[model samples]
Target chain A: MKVIKITAVWCSACLIMNKRWKEIEKDYDVETISYDLDFDEDEVKEYEVGEKLPVFIFLDGDKEIGRLIGEKSLEEIKKYIEELN
Target chain B: MKKLLKYILVFLFFFCFLVNVNAKEKVTLYFFHGDGCPHCAAETTELIKDLEKRDDIKVVKYEVWHNQENSAFLDKVMAVYKTKTGIPYNVIGDTAIVGYNEANKFEIERALEYYKEHNDKYRDVVKLIKEGKEVKINDHYSKQDDKTDKDTTITIPFIGEFNVKNISVGSAAVLIGLVDGFNPCAMWVLLFLITALIGLKNRKRMILLGSIFLLTSGLVYFLIMFSWLNIIISVSTSILFRTLIGLFAIGAGIYNLYAYIKNRNQDDGCDVVDEKKRKTIISRIKKFTREKSLIIAILGIMALAISVNIVELLCSAGLPLVFSELLAINNITGMKAVVYDLIYVIFFMLDDFIVFFIAVKTMDVIGFSTKINKYSHLIGGIIMLLLGILLIFAPGIIMFNF
Candidate 1:
C-alpha cells in the first residue's frame, strides 16, 4: 500500500502526524510518501489535496483509494487502512 | 615613665572621641501614608524635607493605600496606641504622631531630640524587631523605662494583647479561610450540586438554588462562630483554655498532614470526607433531588446545604476552630466580633465562588477542577500543618508581623 502524507512546515497538526507516521511506518512495513503543501504543490495538486494540510491519501497502484483528514490516532489510521479494501 | 604616660593619655583621648562620634544617635522614623491623600503627600514631603538636613534622622515611608501589608502594619501601630483613626501617621521612638500638622511636626522633632538623648529606650524594640519578634510600637517601644518592671503582657494588633502568645486575627482568618475553601468535601459537594443542576437544564433555577445553598452555608457557619464568640468572650481571660485550643490546632494539623500523605494518589479522598460517606451523601442527594415539587425541592436543597456544611466542618474544621480560638484569645466582642466573622466568611467562600462560577460557565472544559480536587489534600495538608505548628510553637507567624 502507498500512503501519501500531505503536510506543511507551519501546520502544527501536520507536525504531530509526522511524528506518529515515523513510528507507524517502522512498525507496519508500509511505504509512506510525504509531500509539502507549499514547495511540492504539483504533487499535492495532482493528488487533489484540499486546503487542509496534514491529510493522508491512501492509494493502491496509481488510483486513490481513501483519505484521512485532520488529526487521527495510530489506531484510527490503522482502522482506515484495514477498511481500504 | 613620663613618655609612656603621655602615650596612654593620647590613646584615651582618641577612644573617647570615637565613642562620642558613634553616639550621634541615628533614629529611623516610620511614616505611613496613603496614596492620593493630599494632606499625606504634603505632610510626607515636608517631613522628608525637614529630615533631609539631619544625617542622624532616617525616614522610612510606607504607602498604605495600595499595600495591604503596610496598611496592616499601620493598623497594628494604631491598635497599640489605642488610637483608631486615619493616616499620615509617624512613629519615632515611643511617640506615634497621627496626621501631619505644624504642631505634630514640632512634636515629632521634640520626640526625636528626646530619643537622641535617650536612644537606649527604643533600641531594644528595634533589636527585637530586627531579630524577628512581633514587636509593636505602642506595646513595646512607647512605654517609659521605669514601667518596664511592671508591664507583663505584650500587645500585638488584630490578635490583641494575649498572655500566652501573640498572633494577628486578620491574617489568621485569611490563611485558614484559603485552606478551608479548598476542602475536598466541599468541592465534591459543589461539583455534585452543579452536575445535578445542569441536568435540570434551567439556568435560573440553578442560580437560585446555588445562591440559597451558599447563603445557608454561610448562615450555619456564622451561627457556629457566634456561639463560639460568646463562649470565648466569657472566658477570654483564661490562659489555660487558650493553651488547650493551641493544642487542638496542632492535633488537627497533624491529621491533615497524615491524610495528605496517605491518600496522595486516591481519586476521592482528602480527609475532609471519607469515600464511603461521600458516596452515601451523593446517593442521598440524587434521591432527594428526584422529587418534583418546587417547595419540596427547595427544602431538599436547603437540607443538602445543611448536611454538606456539617460534613465540610467535620473535614475542614481545623482552620475555623483555629480562627475561633484565635478570636477567643483576642477578646473580640460586640460589633467588632461580628465584623470579623463576616470578613472570615467572605474569605472562606472565595474558593467555592471561583469553582462554582467556573463550573457553571465552562462546565469543566479543561478538567482543572478534577485536578485541583486530586491535589487539594496535599495543598490543604501543608497549610494546616504549618499553621498548626505555628499555633503550638511561635504563634507570632499567625499575624504575619515577621
Candidate 2:
C-alpha cells in the first residue's frame, strides 16, 4: 500500500504530521510521499486536494481508495491499513 | 489749480477708507422667526429700528411659521447647530441666540461685532444662503435639484461625484466586512486555539493565550489591509485586476458550495482542515503546554497565531480581497480608508471575541466550539456562494457604484 500526505510548512498541524510521518515510515512497510500545498500545486491539483492540509490518501497501486483528514492515531491508521490489505 | 487738486486727493483718500470699512465691517444676522409670534414681531421691530441707526448690521429674515421653504431652511440650520427647538432663532457668524429678551440685546450686538471681526468662518455659509443654496452641515443629507427632480450630487472626498443610487460606498464596506467576518478559515483557527487551550484546564492560561492569539490576528489583518490598500490605490483603475477579483470570487464560491454539499449531513462540517492537520495542531499545542514556563508557552502561541494566517488565507482570502478591492474602486482613502479598515477588522474579530470570552469565562469552550463547528460549513458556504455570484455577475450590488 502507498500513502500520499498533503501538507504545508506554515501549518502547525502539518508540522505535527511531518514528525509523525517519520515515525510512520519506520513502523509501517508502506511507501509514503509528502507534498507541500504551496510548492506542489501540480500534484495537489492532480490529486483533487482542497485547501485543507495534512491529508493522507491511501492508494492501492495508483487506484485511489480511501482518505483520512485531520488527526488520527497511529494505531487507527495501522488498523485501516491492515483492513485494506 | 494745485490747491484744488490737493483738496480733491484728500477727499478721495477719505472716501476710499470709508468704503473699505463698510465692506469689511458689515455682518449678516440670519433671523428665523415665526410670523404670528408676538415676541418675534417685537424683536423684529426693535431689530429694524436698531439696524436703521447702524450701518454695520444686515438682517436676513426667514418666517418659519408662514413659509415652508423658510421652515425647512430653519430646520436644516437648527439640525446643523444642534440647537434647542424654538422659533425666534438667530444665527450671526459662529454665534447663535435662541430667544429674544432684554438681556439678549447685548449678545446680539456682541455677535454682530464678533462676526464682522472674524468673517472668514461664515463666508461660505453666508454666500450659500445668499445664492439660495442649502448650507451643507452634514454630507449625508440630500438636497433636491429642481432641474432633474433628483438629489443634488456633491463630490464626496473619497468616493468621487455622489451617485444617487441604492447604497453609498461607505455602507457597502460595512456590509462586506460583516460578511467577511464570518469567514470559515478564521473560524477554523479560532476553534483550534480554543479547543487546544481549554484542554489544559487552566482558565488563566486560556485567557492569556486567547488574548495573544486574537491580538496577533487583529494586528496581522490590519497590516494586510494596509498592503491591500496600497495596491488598490495604485492600480485600482485596471480592468484586469477587477476581472481577476470577479473570477476569484466565483471560484471560491463554487468551492465553498461544493464543501457544503459534500458535508451537508455530516457532523464534521467542512473539512477545510483535514484530520491529520487537526491531530498535528493538537500535538503542537500539547508541546506548547509542556513548555518549561507558561510565559514561553504564551509567546509561542503568539508566534503560532502569526503563522496561522498564511494557512487561513487559503480558505478566507476571498472575502477580504473583494472588500479591499471594492474600497479601492470606491476611492476611499487617507483617514477615511483607515476608519473603514478599522471597522472591517472590528467586525471580523467579533466572532472570535465572542468565542474567546465564552471560553475564558466559563472554561468550557471545547463543547461550545464543537456545537458551532457543526453548522460552520453550511452558513459560510451559503454566504460565500451568494457573495460570489454578486461579485461575478453584478459587483455594483455589493459596491453600489461598481
Highest DockQ model number: 2
- State interface RMSD in Å for all models: 18.5, 7.9
lDDT of 1: 0.63
Pairs that clash in candidate 2 = A69-B274, A69-B275, A69-B276, A70-B274, A70-B275, A70-B276, A71-B275, A71-B276
> What CAPRI-style quality would you assign to candidate 2?
incorrect
* Poorest 10 consecutive residues by lDDT, candidate 1 chain B: B364-373
Question: What's every prediction's RMSD, in angstroms?
Answer: 20.1, 16.2
Q: Tens digit of lDDT per residue, candidate 1, span A1-65?
A: 88898865434345457776887787675788988755586787787655444678888888888
Q: Which lDDT tens digits does candidate 1 get at residues B103-164?
A: 56666777778777777764534334445567655433343322322233576699876432
Candidate 1 chain A, poorest ten consecutive residues by summed lDDT = A7-16
- Reference A-B contact fraction recovered by candidate 1: 0.00
- Candidate 2 lDDT over residue span B1-402, tens digit each: 999999999999999998876667457778877655555676788874676567667777777654666666665665555544354677776456655655455567766776666665444354465576765543211211122212334678888875453246556556556656665565656766676677778777778777988998888887788688767655443334555776777777677667667755543313445647655665676677657687898887777777777667665777677677766644455675687788888777877788678778877442122223334445555655675566445543453331
Worst 10 residues of 2 chain B by lDDT: B140-149
Q: How many clashes in each structure?
A: 0, 8
How many angstroms is residue B360 displaced in model 1 relative to the true structure, after the best TM-score fit?
3.6
